[model samples]
Target chain A: MESTQATNHVSYLQHKPHKIGILNWILSTDHKRIGLLYLYSIMVFFIVAAFLGLLMRIEKFAPGETIMDAQTYNGVFTVHGIIMIFIIVIPGLAAVFGNFFLPILIGAKDVAFPKLNLFSWYIYIAGAILALISQFASGGAPDTGWTFYVPYSADSSTNVIWALTAAFILGFSSILTGLNFIVTIHRLRAPGMSWFRMPLFPWSIYATSWIQVLATPIVGITLLMVIAERTLNIGFFDPALGGDPILFQHLFWIYSHPAVYIMILPAMGVVTEIFPTFSQKPIFGYSAIALSSVAIAAVGYFVWGHHMFTTGISYWSRWFFSFLTFIVAVPSAIKVFNWISTMYGGSIDLKPPLLWAIGFIFLFMIGGLTGLVLGALATNVHVHDTTFVVAHFHYIIFGGMGFAFFAGLHYWFPKMFGKMYNIKLANISFIITFIGFNVLYFPLFIIGLQGMPRRYFDYFPEYQYGHVISTIGAFILIIGIFIMLFNFFRGARKGEIAPANPWKGVTLDWQIESPPTLLNFDEIPVITEKPYTFKKEEEA
Target chain B: MEDKKHHISSFNSLLMVLIGLFIMTGISVMITEIHFSTFSVGVALLLASIKGYLVLTYFMHLKYDEPIFRIMVFLILLLFAIVIGITFIDYLLR
Candidate 1:
């Protein structure tokens, strides 16, 4: 269905630059370059956070203050949470892969606004710098945690205001990127590419952009209010100053809850794309998988009140929120089931990407099921502030979204760089990461059920056994992470040359050169069929 | 896209909008001073909302923008209003 004109000569990497060296990359308006830039920067932050997490686990290995004091432990965990939530996962797949592939997947050359896309990276870097400064700028590292829950945040001697401001700026960065994607998706589809004809990855990005645009402002305003509370003595959240703390919780979760969707939706998009490609079948239910992302994004907003359940909200509000939270699982389950159905009776390749995708489904199911337990008013009371909540979120965010990120990276690595990493090493790393991840987190559930609290430097002797196992597991997980990073880094420099369509996928991105040129298409592709149809070869 | 001439409010109309906003603010303050204590918040919110509406419609040119932009904005407002309504349910019940 595609009609090609005279092709562009240069691949994107070979495209000439106006500036030399680092400036060429930094100033480049190519979405692919910017995507790689985001990938590199985000990986650095992820590594930092991972190391901090390892330290936390190390200190937890024996008992009280194994390596650091309580205050230091608190600060480390808080910074880890900030880096992971704000810097790594919030932007996550959509920022990295979405920027790289959204336009190409939809048969467009570039996002609607390339300048804004580059500006967003700069803004992200600026926000990262400001956030780093917040930790070291004042009395000490901010101990308020990433949520910046007030009273403590307001009263804390640390530079909470700077953290708040940094978060505010980062929110702007997120909003701009979201806005760019939304407009690009809306306005830049090539000729004859209808809404349903678009790939699921772009579809999920569309849904995610809406969440980023709509929900991020609430957190931005809330963080600013905390800044105001600290500086202007605004009595908004500090109970000592006649402010209601629950209100702060309300505002915080209002954005942060939906923010979870911002993290997971693009990852869900990745899984949807991977399922059809690896399974060698059209998706079992295209509309269901595509619309489920939107459905998840929509229902995700109303469930924020679930986070405040143990914080003494009223019975009716708590029950209402609990019910709403339960309702969200239906759409999530639909997507998960459809992914499995797509693989049924198909020629499954069992590639590393597909393995990670399957891994995501397993971990996300556990995460989502445990979420129901936390969503219930009765069980929430029992698990609140315990390692239970910590384990539950890690299962979802790290296990589900993190796994999906790896899957997308492996799936699209060839497309991004025109080379393939070692498949054997990739598979090995996935297995190790998966095994270590479960090992590290599973014991937390056991000990948490027995009443171990999270964010503590010390634990009872009874809990020490669990912590010891978990620390060992953490070491395994870190080794896996390092191996995975090493595999990618080594493969990028030296790997097999990948074909244009390595997976024999039917999406628009596969129709192009492996390392696509600076302008994606020579002649803008004219599309006529649904994105995932595998019937092109015989017909052509 | 930017070259498309959206409907622009005249200087006279913008001035009128500003004046209306000022009068609403003044009337809102007056109502609070006159001890409409129960409706004070309601009145202030109403007036502030009007000023916000005027600014958005004229200054931000939503009045001239496409239907999709209007729908996006209306949806955002609806989301906020729904959350506020839910909050009120808990507070009023308490």
Candidate 2:
């Protein structure tokens, strides 16, 4: 059945660039245009956030005597984290790539709710603008870290309420996107595309949208309480007002810890696509990998307590959280094993996307293992508030989410723009980014172990060397990212034209012509067999 | 064509959603008059859930479309209950 639609898609081949007008982009419902809108908007937000980090890094390059004062540095880092995570990275992979590709992958014309898809983009931008404006209006961005923990969050005099409200609105946008994806995947699959036969990327997205729809509201409500407490004096998390501040942490992490998966799962989806196409084989443990995506999403929700282990939570509660944390790791490990096994003895092609995929495996493993160390009650007491925790999260976010974003961009570059990115530049970019990222983040592990706390503007002189090394590494990493942007920009406008199946991928999207029609198909595809069955039907 | 047929039934669900919206707002305002501290909020929420459920079942077409969504919602609610319940347990035990 999948083959029927694949062959039937030959009739549709419309690729005239849609008017390329400002009004067309602003008001468009076409998923590709909307995706480009997201791509450009998120890139701008990332630049703003990245600049804030650079300013702070320069301040901390030495012993941090006085490039910026203490409160200013705190506010800089806070805004950096808030803008990058909330405004950019949170929606980075799924909203940009998943929105563009999922419907295409499933052989559908558009998302389930096309207008809602566009509305989500507008809401995301509105929230981002509001948060950015708060920086100027509210004396500076909130001094509270992105986590916005209570007591500090409850007591802080900065513009925390505006930031929290913006985050809540952003959560609403994410939830709507998730809901649209869920319904679209369920109802809009072309005639024969069964669950097993669908592309692995969309399957992972399917799992991710569930997390978005279900878990986002928890944070939504939590952030609202913070705003209410600040403005209305509602005391839900204020101890003085008969509320437990620690309860705020529980509520925050409940959404946040799963949010870690929210950041990484789509990356996992990208790797799932990359491994099969490059290795020239079906994914080993296809059902395991598919179900594991769902398993991570489900189990990911219960393990938030592990984040609060050192925060005066009860002993038994700590044990429960630790145990559940271990359980969540099993599915994550299963995915790793499956990817490695997929590459075992297969006719592997060493493409740029493949390099990033393999890089993700190596770095993501480091991040995941260290997470166990922190998940344990005894060890967490030592590392909970330190630079080690900061380092661990960067490895996961930078190494995990950041690497996956590049991999997906490269893997789908041809499909997205009907052109090939400079392979040489891509490989160079990956190498520099990988080395620079580790150089920047890895030392924080050592300094963090030696008792350096996170979110502090001033540090002990003993930590000066690590800080300098990290500062230098940040420059290298930024250069690598700059190379990526240049390569993609050049490729989109002037690179070699891409064929329909540039990588010889087996997914439904590649079965169609490059720069697929607005509707994606002249006829809906039907599926009769499993996806990526490269061995049984060898294609050399 | 299937697209046109699907459109007609889809409109029924949209109308049901609008009807649920009116019912929810009416129930919420009326409950303020009854005025029982926790109970009022609880009853209002219960009515809201019923409205949401009706919207889900009839409008979203969950009754016939797929079981995964219903199960997903049920699981989410179950987890919410567990988190709130366990927190309350610790409070009582202390």
Candidate 3:
């Protein structure tokens, strides 16, 4: 497979058609370049949002008005949630890794719709810029929070409209990306790469694309309704105009709950790739993991009501949602079981990527279990809107998706950049990040159970202890992230050249050059075996 | 890539589908005059679903496409129905 391809072809990085300096990247229709474009832009937004999160943590260190007023605090957290959710995590793995690797993994030269792939990035940037503008615009940042619940959002003096419009536009970007992936996966597979023969990452992307395509429009229209309620006084959610606010919650969570799956499924897919490669073994249950991705997406749709369990929805509705929420966990748990079982009998190489992959499983398990605590109707009422819910969310989003993003980045860094980051530095950074992340979020659970609410600018002195520990953890976590990123930056610039197959793994991406050429392969290879095929001879 | 044969619908087939849609629209508007109380919205939705099925099957050419596509469409409709039904659980129970 390696000997059949051209060895001297120019990498996509130095490929020449778009000769303009910056325009070479921004205007390029290449999927790999477009994937990097998403990577760079998402990194920028992640830094901004992480800074905002750090600021909020700082303010919470001391009980009363540590740095900013309550209004400013509201604005900070709102912007943080908006950027992190919309710009960073939702498109995090799929946009960056899926775009870059999905085609190569499936033995295609590029995605089915390459131009549309680039167009999605442009739309994403447009939406991201609009979100940033909402912060600096005339009326001040939106205080409605990211959810933009009605009545307050409809009547808020702040720039809620800008935020709403930004979210709506971002939803369009999501839909387009999803649409592109669906077409690409459907149409662009290599000759013999049957459905089951394709890797788990593409399978996860396929499932996530469905959620993105079908679920995003609901949020798009829901956001538009809020805009209309504000601008036209149409009263879609305003009680004064005979609208139901609970209905808004329903519409929002209908998409938003499935949106959680959108965020995590790709992360799951990333780790699925990492676990098998690092363990040097066949995946435990290929069909189960692949089908579980689809199951999570499908069942993820009906579990939105769990988020609204405390919102005065009917008892039966609450019960139904709770039951479905628990049911959704089964597929996720199946995935976790499969991951752990893959590592059980294999000769495991615990490198930086594997460490992060292991970290993802640990943290995601905590996140998933706590999610069950919240899924239970009785327990949810106890912790609803508390820091406990906040902790659960960060664990899932940051611990699950965020950690998996880092794991994928490290795993594919050599392949993507043809450079090897310092292994010691990456390992140290992961340790710091793992410790800091838990330190930052775990206390919130304790304090939340002790009766501390979330999104509040101040807290009682009793809660100050937890807040201080959590803030310290935030600083440590931020330092670790910067170090990890800096290591990658240095590696990309001046590191040892990486081999085609750094981990000696069996996958199409690994079989190709370190940094793939303009067109990924000289010829699309026909797949004749399942992904993650490990033999004893190769292990030796 | 596998070569796929494009299915082109004929003018008479398209015209018949259009006429069927128009007749359904007229019936939909006329049915508003006499409706069962709680089932009015249900009736309207059922008619709309039929029209949608017609559009998807003929106009959208699902009838001519692969069986997998039809399965996907059916699954999506099932999902849509389940979501709507669950949402109604809240409203009706309330």
Candidate 4:
């Protein structure tokens, strides 16, 4: 603390000049360090899950039990979904970049409860470890899928209890982080930084944290009930004991649907920041874009029932859910248009970060439109559990949220590490990843409509071409990811020294030193102007 | 000063909220005494909302807090109501 003692010039990378080393990271409460900690940990899980996904794709390449057995294939995708959903993507953006940039953006030193922030990371790791342990627990890995649906989960011989309990604990980690962000945003903005004047990223985070706080608990309770049913022979979801399976689904999705927003809203926030910063213009319709995050979160809850339309819900319920699902498109579409408008006629800087953000918009629009397809009662019945649904989810979760995470990572890389990555290589990686992603998922849309079902170890000869194409795309995509990560690692060590405000932006973060000091601002910045004031300064 | 005005501190207000909660609890039990099965759940929920309102207002100081806080709490409750109501639309329609 002494070495970092309120110096204006020292970046956070130089905190504790002569003190305890890794303990400063694992045990420290600094928000910047906590964000990097999440970055390192989540990336490790991302690679692991990506490999799992590749294996699943390989098995599907030529159908007919290529390598793994049906049971192993089932277990692989389940664990893959668990690791990707619970460990990596769900908490990815908010935990990593949000933790890193939020305090600096708001002109605060750290989160309101700094120690609680560190505690949540530990909880996340503990839950992740438990999920790994569940893979080897009694009766092998869980095959109930990430949704962990009804009587099967209750009666399965696989380690459903461990998986559910791990998910339940992971919910706590998410809740605490959400609670921390909400409080920090509410109570910690620096002098003169009113709500509307706050940057779009933090505004979206404010929305995400609310969903995390309110929606995560529902999944926690539902998972606990699943554990209770598995262990105690309770008939909560089992038809043998006269319980309705539909209720379990309702409870699961009530949280899971909102949990989807928790995944994407921060990603949208990252895109919001990236667009203007890259385009060298003030954000278009800033207020509408900021409020739409809240609108998406608000509308997210009412439409969970859409996921259940094919499950024999009543006719009226289906219609109600279908209408609400389409309604979510409005706010989401507004954000897409706003991002494009931000880019229009501006001094467009097509950096790696901006490219990824642009990529996110294109991919996410496809995902959202496909989602409306699946939301309708008519089309949903045609592709309910097919590879089409799988492709749709990946495009949204992997393509949308995942690319946005990469965009944030690239955008903040210099600011984060105080080093500039190889720009040429970064651009090349983005193009390949974009092409590979489209090649990987677009074929599934065709085959899925042709009715090739998902989660099977082997497929029919008819679906082989699509499977082969998707598998080849995954490899190319993985290769691009490798080069991008290599550039980041190489940049961190021996790359060009980055100056403060590399992007030449007007956010409070750019006002401070790059790789910001132990406490974010040496002198807490006064918000003299609205955020994203590009060509002109506001009257203070 | 503006925030100070938004917050409540009077012992009288707290005591009055306590009395209202007690009355709501009585009504909640008395409503069960009326014994129409369908109406019982609705009546109990209405009384409970009143009790919850008292707790949130005086006991928890939401009434004293900013309008933003009130809006947030209302939004949360409204979300839950939509979820529950829309979920039941299926079985109710069937």
Candidate 5:
């Protein structure tokens, strides 16, 4: 099983400089290149989706001077959510960074199945193409939003079938990637690396992978039913054929709610890695952080019904889900406590990565705590579909997950490309993105409390001011993201060569040289202690 | 390393799980004849669980993988249980 000393010979290792053909990039199976490919493609989709979001905000900026009509606004938000959830966030961190570094971090030459990883990318692209095609084929991208709840999803005038089918295809891709990562982690850890010794990012990805393999199929089947009922007139979810609409709500949320975890869990892992590296200390309660990941995944499953409390779920079940939802918060809080404890009395470096990690903790705390307010049966009934709910999720998803992602990208940019980012520009980008995100989303909490419902193209005149402020914030957020992107692009190509461990981290991935050779390591290293057991001499 | 060897040798267990899954699929389809509609779905899912268990233990080689992987598989079943249980409770109470 050990192929020690043999030169690593992955297929794309021999890629000549001038051989950068479209077919070469498309057909390649090299994990690093594939990861870069995913990074590029997902970023492209993110920009497109962000543009749609900006359009939505602009249309609503002044209570509708008529930039985009109501129907178009619906299409805009739906497409924005679809692209962001399906295209960028879900795949971006895991598929790009996970694929790039997990095997390398573990001292493996490649994932157990290289070909399957490439195929997953193809499936993702295919799903993306099908969804994009629907924009032109019918009325527009499905206006049902990403959740695509039953009656609306089943009966929407737009091309809902294509979107559902695309989602189903993407689910298979996600499941396969999950299965691959699970197998790789199980079978291919470097000789000395025990499960307990693995890095937190991989630990987080492991939890996310399990969620993906299990929950993804349910969504696959659920969406398949959506397509089936529409095409064959089955009564599985469509209300017209004796199918209960609430059943659709159940089936949809069963997957969609956990889907939120799928989006957040990996970012949690990324933040877990960053905290240790930048704080200049081993993570406090390492086992607790690792186990809490699993805890969140396990508890995440029971709480999907919280999303449906407003839609007339049974009172008993509502109470049960609401309780479980609150229970789920405990583990998340444990993670926050562990992170804060890691920073306590430690020689913390306020580097860009650490800044974002701290930012994530602050915003995620706000989000997770507010989530309890939403999970309570009484409180949710009032704010269920309002901007409060929207704001809460944005805090968690965008503020929590999005900021961590930025932190991770900056932290690893040097390692990924053997270059150093412009710290001044990175800091500026961070400030703009953070402030803009808060400005864009925080106002929603206030307006929502004042009775502003979400998903509306236009609103009351008084609300117009809030919407305008939010729209301006969205612009600032986009500019910040662009600046970050530009800095990274320039840094990667021309910046200073990164040392093997630029941040002086102790993870196995940092043990390897920057821009590692195709096989990651010449020899599979063994581990004996916790990953961040920093030597006392290095501390001083 | 120990887990990998065990998985490599569990070829028989994998086959057994496949056979069991197919059998459960047959039983689920056959149970449509039983007059109780809710009972049929329950039986079908029960069989499906057995099949799921078999696959988790054998094909996925979780039986030989570390305790954590096994814990993961169990966690998934627990989740499945909660979803089905709550949904049925609501369905019946209604």
Candidate 6:
């Protein structure tokens, strides 16, 4: 395997542009640097949101006003949801991993529009700052849940406008990043690396980019409508002002639901890359996995109505959405089956990345299956606003996407930083995090099923047992997260240097130096084979 | 460096498209004056979509571009139509 020193390649980290110091990172247009900028920024936001989440869990320990008052609890969860959804997970995998690796995986020098890519990160920061301002500005943090549902959002006296504007700006950033990825993938693939020959990560990014471009505008316009309603009293969603509140729901979910696919497809793509490398086998049903990403994105658009089942949408609309929801699950299940099959009968490495991938499947299955329970018209009405929905969402987003992010980070950490992390520590952190995650969320399912409503600061005494257990689980999860982060930090500073292909993978990324040089390849090599051709390696 | 020739619309062709867009806008305004009751919003959307089509075809050069661009545009329009059509299912039933 090749090493960066062996190739005399200057890593993107070492290469400095015209700008010196911090400006080199914040001002540079190199995709890798921009990706690290996103990674660092997202980590900051994730910690903030996770802390807010921990506060919420602690408050739930004994129910009524354990740590904070009702209003404060509302503000905490609202900000938590906003930070996690818009700032972290939605852009998490794609912005951080996709920007860093997409060009390398596809054998390109950089994304087609590097400057626009940097601009997206700046817009993201501006939006994030606005969100922070919303929290501490004149009025208290907007109590409107991250959904910022109608009538209440329109009437709320809090700094709702700032939050809405922040979301709108963030959505715009998402759209631009998506646009850049689409063009890069379309125009810049290596000579012989056709669509089919491209790896799953880029394919997933391609699908996610399309969703970001197409679906995000709907949310942007919808949020602006909310802003207009709040500021100008435009009567877009206020029923008293002759606006239909349900219309707001329709527009919001039109984008937000597809936005879910935008979050998960790349996660699915990340695990797909990991399974093949660790298992030392070609990905099973390569075309199926690739096409499933697009299929999920396409089908994801029409199923937004499932969210409105109890919003009193028409029966036929509910039925249509319910049916489409079930259909969307099919493509997701296909990807899962293919991943497991990829690992079947192969030389499994059982590395930390693989452990996270396997954990993703376990957690995502729970999230996905419970999603069907929520999708069914009969069952959805029962748990519409219950803690059950909360559990399901966390299992999917936090358990699924969050775990997949860790998997990709561990898998590519060496390649990205040219340093290998502590393998034993990495594995231990995954175990703690996995167990803690399940413990934190699992009880919510039980209590949610028992009729405990979500978003309330206080709950009945009967639900106390579940909340206490869940809060304990929250602490455990946080400990695991810190350990994993510390391990990465320590490894980056003082660990053994990584080989170019530590896992003996056949993908183009592994074929390059550990930390790739500026403009990636010395010369663009023509690819003439499938992306994951590990048969030769297996024979050897 | 490049082999594919860029398609530049003729001056007359561009002017004709501009006139057509203006006429459509005028019709859109005129249609609003005579309300079709429940069909009013539908009529307005139809007119707006026609204007959008003209802009995309002539101004955006989708008409002269490769088939893939046109196909992608068509698919997007179809998706938008489906979303709107599905939303109406609730209102119409209610």
Candidate 2 per-residue C-alpha lDDT over A419-464 given as tens digits, one digit per residue, 9 for 90 to 100: 8989999999999988888988998899998998988788889999
lDDT at position A426, candidate 1: 95
Model 1 clash pairs? none
Whichever of 3 and 6 has more DockQ, that candidate is: 6
lDDT of 4 by residue, B1-94 (tens): 6765766478987788788888877877776668776565567777778788878877888876779889989988887777777676666787
Q: How does model 3 score on DockQ?
A: 0.68
Alpha carbon lDDT of each predicted model: 0.89, 0.84, 0.92, 0.88, 0.83, 0.92
- Which residue ranges in model 4 land beyond 4 Å of their true spot? A1-8, A536-540, B1-71
Q: Per-residue lDDT for A1-540 in model 4, tens only?
A: 011223346677777754778877887788999999999999998999999999998988886888899999989999999999999988999999889999988989999999999999999999999999999877899999999998888888899888998999899999999999999999999999999989999999999999999999888988888787777867677888756899899999999999899999999999999889888889999999989999999888788888887788888888888999999999999999999999999888888999999899999999999998998889999999998999999999988999999999899998899899999999999999998999899999999999999887877899999999999999999999999999999999999988777886768777766677788766777777788887553531
lDDT of 6 by residue, A64-181 (tens): 7788998888889999999999999999999999999999989899999999999999999999999999999999998999999988888888889999999999998999999999
B1-94 per-residue lDDT for model 3 (tens digits): 3446678899999999999999999999999899588787699999999999999999999999999999989988888888878887788998
Q: Which residue window of length 10 is worst by lDDT in model 1 chain A? A: A1-10
lDDT of 1 by residue, A153-232 (tens): 98988877877888888899899999999999999999898998889999999999998999899889889888888889
Screening candidate 5 with a backbone cut-off below 3 angstroms (N, C-alpha, C), the clashing residue pairs are A192-A526, A192-A527
Clashing pairs in 6: none
Report the C-alpha lDDT of model 2 over B13-86, residue by residue, as the tens digit.
67867887897889788777886864654576678778877776777667765467689778777887787665
DockQ of 5: 0.48
User: Candidate 4, after superposition: displacement of residue B39 in Å?
Assistant: 7.8
Ranking by TM-score: 6, 1, 3, 4, 5, 2
Candidate 1 lDDT over B13-38, as tens digits, reads: 99998899889888877776676654
Name the lDDT value of residue A292 in candidate 5: 93
Which runs in model 6 stand beyond 4 Å of their true positions? Answer: A1-5, A535-540, B1-4, B10-34
Error of 3 at A340 (Å): 1.5
Per-model TM-score, in order, reads 0.96, 0.89, 0.94, 0.91, 0.90, 0.97
Candidate 6 residue A460 Cα shift, in angstroms, is 0.6
